[model samples]
Target: MRKLILAIAAALPSAAVAGGYIVPNTNPRDLSMAGSAMAAQDSAGAAYANPAALSKLEGLNVTGGVSLIDFRSTWTDSARIADGQAVTMIPKGAFPFVLFAGYGLKLANGMKLGVGGGVNIPGGGYSFWPGNWPGRYQIVTVDRKVYGMYLTSGLQIMPQVRVGGGLVYYRTTEHLIQGINFLGYDSSAELGTSGGAVSFDLSTEVQPLKTIPLTIGVDYKHQAVQHLSGHGHFDNPPPALQGYGVVDQPATHVLTYPNRLEVGASYQVIPQLLVTAQWTWERFHVYKSDVFNGGLGFSLAVNRDYKNGYTLRLGGEFQALPQLKVRGGILRDISPVRPETLDPTLPEANVWAGALGVGYEVMPGLQVDAAYFHAFYDTITAAGADQAFPGTYDTRANIWSLAVSWKTDLLQRRK
Candidate 1:
């Protein structure tokens, strides 16, 4: 039974590792270009990726899209008596959906304005672990959901320069179930929490030369921390471990969303082709929270020591035909959680990614976009100190997106 309690402990730390959540590509067009929207963006998506882009539009534009993520992983126990055998304790895959929308308007004052928003699913993952599985005593199941919303604006300072910013909000819900061992008896508890937070984002773009189709873009976003409060229901437990038979106790937690910055450039080598590159830095070190004061003033401490993370992305778009465009790109994503902080609650690892997509000009003012992306993660083997959940994790993910955009001159003032 003691082993069961320790196993549960191994999975608990991950519940607080929310700072590692990655927002998958929300725009189908952006996904196809491997999320290289920092500078080479068109349509209303610019409202979120780089609002300054709104100033380049001719009239009014609206863009909307939906994305589906398929995440899968394989976990193994090195200490297995069967000599390093794979464990089938958890679900093999999870599917999550993302939605996005943006609108841009070109005013008569030579200024551009735009608004955009999106719904992101916490990257796909499994929350269920079998009670009889080797690691069941450590964790039975964990489920979490997070939603984000934002309103953004942009202004064109000159024909070749623009700047923009926005306010963002988030809501979160979580549920956890784990088995506990005490006095030779096995019991379980169900815990849940809900909370929200608000943050901000800023961005800018510049064109240095008029003769070259080259542009530079920079973007930044503030950090947000969610203060969650809820309760836990303890199932039947040994008398020595339970104050009252199957009672409830207060539960509270905090999740820190990291701050991030991105800088990139895009160039149109020719009238029919565009290429881009970008780098992103994330401050995941802020994910330090060893304790939380509950509703009744009791403290619950959970340690999480994480490092900063980074990502590099490159992409291109080619005008294959008068009515169709082809896109492709690649990226490298790094993880912030060190080996010691790695846990099964949400296994995270560095990844290499590739994408492909296409755009169809269905009509004079309407376009449709579709894209697919795949991420290949490095196999992680944890066996030393800080390897709280000592095991091996193989992870990978795939994403599919589709969107439609429309533009019209109706919003322009009649001459």
Candidate 2:
């Protein structure tokens, strides 16, 4: 009841806010160490990370953040090039959005219930530089958008424990584009796809220690199956050389859906300070299909889908004043990618981060928040993809971000 609305402390800048190589495969935020799910309370932002935290909110709230990812992925092997020519430079971009809204109501018995939803960017791929877009292949663009929502109810089942659970729904759209050769002619082909899924979350918050001002919460979230496919189209067809062929743009690639699991926790050192952590698991090997083609309108090929991976996050905050805060966090992204599935498009790695922010109350029921953060990643290989590709190439990336949050009371005055 003493926490004031924060604006700068919760928002992120452009670079760290979007999906990129080192930042995160998904949306980045200014919340804390654990960028995805935070230890925040009262604000509508908690719903995206843990629905059970929604009951703690006292009013109707809305929050949204954007993460802009900047990176470079290049092809270094002259042998991989079609005509014995190698690529030295590459440029790419990914802008991801994370939206959130929440509302809470108190019952006659004093228990709380809440609901919230949003559009999230799980990941993206856009590695198009100068020479041949790297690897033994190229991708003009790889964009994806995902949406989901949840309704949760928390009951003070006992004096020290609160139990809660909720159902979730997801929707998505993904677009893919790649260019090879027009066979001496000038032609292009691009593809687009759409898919969705459903999931659930179960959580509990408990006050285990009485002497220390503290509370702990644990949450689990799972996503259902999501199927995806993209259709391709040809523009202008080029000519052929030596009968082998020259393509301005070849076919496209298609993939199926996968599942995900997430677990997180939050701890408060005092009314104005707290720390948090989270782990996420995603299964891509469940992906099945064959051939990454381009000759026709699409590309298909057999692949050794990678195993699941984990993202570990940790962050905390310090309130210099009632309305100001300084924060920082770090994440280790150990991908389960195999040497065979490696492509220049999605080269996984580990990332580190730092952030600062401020929040304010301009008037009753009205508030504004802002935040800043920086993320760093170590180089990794995008090898094993494209039968034409030979070895894993070297690469690295950096993400910087800034964000804002605004909220007002609709039904009641909550945090």
Candidate 3:
């Protein structure tokens, strides 16, 4: 019995985002416009969003930026209280951030090349309470982090058509701790895992009508499966479980990060005014592995049964002045988690988000950008049916970002 339980604990957690995870727009300038830069990428973000748009960029351009995300939530379970106290848990707000940098070069005859990479802390939060808390057995502390890097390129097929794509590498790390009753003795378990994988992306853009100021773009990113291996440790084990001890297993489980597809269009309403809309589809249904079989007869599995999800975004940009531009947009995303699986590890929910931002030309070849975003989510509730946790989860988040990019013709002049 002890061996079976320990083997189950060896499996790590999984990641699927319908809200507050897998942020598509990493550029501060684009985030300001609610990630509407798909068809109107005027900055160095082309390398990440739609590499096909690179042809629209000129000369040598370098961009750098960062985004700060703040997470807040409260979990309540009246039936699980132990000491006749308030049945509530408020997670300490977490400040996770993303960093980005990219460079693009325009070659002769409408050809473009770009290389870029960044770090994304898509989803992961920490929760803590006294060891005697009623929900202690469910969870205590969970720290999960995911990040990725990529390189891309683009070319103009015709005067109004372009195509692009790139390759990516991703990594995820997780740590979880929970309390258990062992022969009437208080005991705790710690589990850890870390692994990396490779993926790729493809994109294209076209102007269907030259007489109109309209541009359409689309992109696809392949899914990644992280194969991780780690260990489990027990503290203060009771005599019955003393034989289990500390077990160190290496590289055993696998987690799937869903694939994604996005399509966007931009229309210039007037000379200086532009409007854009985008739709994104996440193939969460393809995520089937709930258990990871680490080699050496060690394996773990959990049931997620996630469903596919989508996001809709709309934004507009105005060239208020020759040197300044203003932008705003809104988004609605559906959650992928099925109700029975809602737990502290991933308290996900449907969300509505809005953003406001602006860009300014510090000089002829230098641009600075800034934007702010807020997300509101629906409360999640479960009655403990089907053996799932019984409780309510309320959550929300905020983000702030800033960036700078420089475009120069020095390379062209040197030639």
TM-score of each: 0.88, 0.75, 0.88
Put down candidate 1 lDDT per residue, 256-339, tens digits, no spaces.
667888898999989999999998888988876445544444455566677898888999999999999999999888878766
Q: Report the error of model 1 at residue 63, Å.
A: 2.8
Cα RMSD (angstroms) for every candidate in the order listed:
3.5, 9.8, 3.1
Instruction: Go through the candidates in order and give each one's C-alpha lDDT.
Output: 0.70, 0.50, 0.70
Q: Model 3 over residues 188-232: C-alpha lDDT tens digits? A: 877787888999989999999999989999989889988876766
Clashing pairs in 3: 229-251, 229-252, 252-294, 290-302, 291-301
Q: Relative to the unseen true structure, what is the C-alpha lDDT of residue 391 in candidate 3, on a scale of 0 to 100?
A: 67
Q: Which stretches of candidate 3 lie over 4 Å from their true place?
A: 1-21, 78-133, 245-251, 294-296
Q: Quote the positional error of residue 133 for candidate 3 in Å.
A: 4.1
Off by over 4 Å in 2: 1-31, 36-40, 78-93, 131-137, 149-159, 182-187, 238-258, 288-299, 353-365, 382-387, 391-410, 413-415
TM-score pick, better of 1 and 2: 1
